[model samples]
Target: MGGDPISLNQDADLHLYMDGEMEPARRAAFEAQLASNPALAAKLDEYRHQQDMLRLGLDMMAAVSVKETETLAGRLRWRLDMDRFSRRVAPLAAAMLLVMGGWSLTVWVQSGAGTGPQLAGEVDDVPAFADEAAEAHSKAIALNTLQPSPPQVEAAPVPMQTAQVPLPEGHVMTVTLPAIGPELTLIRASIVPWNHGTALQFLYREPDGELLTLFVASGGPAQDGTLHTVVQDSLRLVYWRAGLVAYTVTGNKADGDLLTVAKKMADSIRRS
Candidate 1:
């Protein structure tokens, strides 16, 4: 109550946020601040007023079976307006608000909206985004390199000459592969299907002929800060979460080199 006017204003904003009426950018900004602002976060928690939006949304879509429901990968690309996060942000980000009743409501433009039981609280069950990226990177490389004589599908041929490739929902993405730079070079960019959902993949060729794969999805094991580093076998991945999109940069390069490019890519996306 020290600054009665400002405190009252924030209180009203909190109410609006819980009502699912807060603008997407503003809501994410507030959540990001909560991670570093313990006092503000604690105050919000004391008045934890639950909302019924997700519940209502679920009953309306209950007829949809689990197969038609949104998977973790699908939820990643869903619009930010339909989701919310815990104000008690920590080293590991978990879901709190958007999840309601018992299931997490996922709304995607491509796939009709529905709910799923794979809620975010059980931290151990949540797949590590970095590890996922490394696996995706290795898979993409193996598919392209190891299977050199891939049987040609007589489908429409893909054009090979484009400076800045765009994904299907390119407008909705936060990260875009940049032009060749000191840190890295962009070779190709496209959207690929993963886990029955779409992922924005950017392939970059290192000076040493190693290919670096960057995967951008709507959500994953994301914490707001420097890119996290994870190594598995011969692959290394650096990844982070931003707003609705989680970005992972993976490669076979040395740790330092991989990290440098990862940070550069993350910074560019943030700046744009």
Candidate 2:
């Protein structure tokens, strides 16, 4: 409300709407536009994803009522740790059985006969963070750093790098990486510069042989401030903000796993 609203089109506008900062009439107008626009509806779905996940994380982590709790970090961390272990094993155990049996299959595949239905002239309503993360992930695969690019570059791997200096944006801020699980270990911490600002992309090696990157950008908290996943070609990213930072954990089709990590990270941060 303090800054001049820009036709209410910016990310902060999403914040304002979710934050209930708009007047009743303005909010109704925005809702009208949203209802009539499928693209806008899809975008709001992304924001809502985050909001729901964050709320779930809080509920899972909250011990006593907020009014009753003091020094509750330990309780929250224990629950998060338990949740983390439960998620990690369920998948690996299933996959390991396949590997042992020499079984392999893909769940989905797109044909190259120009049969896919992408808009020829239609525009995407997805947020910039999703686009940025997807592009970088594709490139990371193209470079063949960790694995071979999927034929679909048909795909490859990401080369890992660490950054110990400020990014070009002149300001550097990052959230704590998810508390590492035994099944995954940190691999790379690199500066990923996006259109709005620089995001610190922390890469991790998972047991599945695929890679994970967590992008953290500072100072642009969405008003809704929730955890949501944006699913797209070549990648999936779960985004949310806490305190001064907005964070996303992206991967090469790790939509479900990413959200699990996101919720754990969110819970971990909220614990303190």
lDDT of 2 by residue, 1-272 (tens): 12332344745566778778877878887787666666666666778999999999998887455532332455458757976997889688768867786333222211111222111121235567666766766566445453544343221333222234344547544345445556565665577767876767666667776777776665555433466666667356666666666666677543445656666666655554
Q: What lDDT tens digits, residue by residue, belong to model 1 across residues 19-72?
A: 688999899887765665666666666556222565667778875656323453
- The candidate 2 region of ten consecutive residues with least summed lDDT is 110-119
What ranges in model 2 sit over 4 Å off?
1-124, 145-174, 222-225
TM-score, structure 1 vs. true: 0.41
Clashing pairs in 1: 76-218, 76-219
Candidate 2 lands at a TM-score of 0.44
Best by TM-score: 2
Q: What lDDT is obtained when candidate 1 is compared to the true structure? A: 0.55
Q: Pick the candidate with the highest lDDT.
A: 2
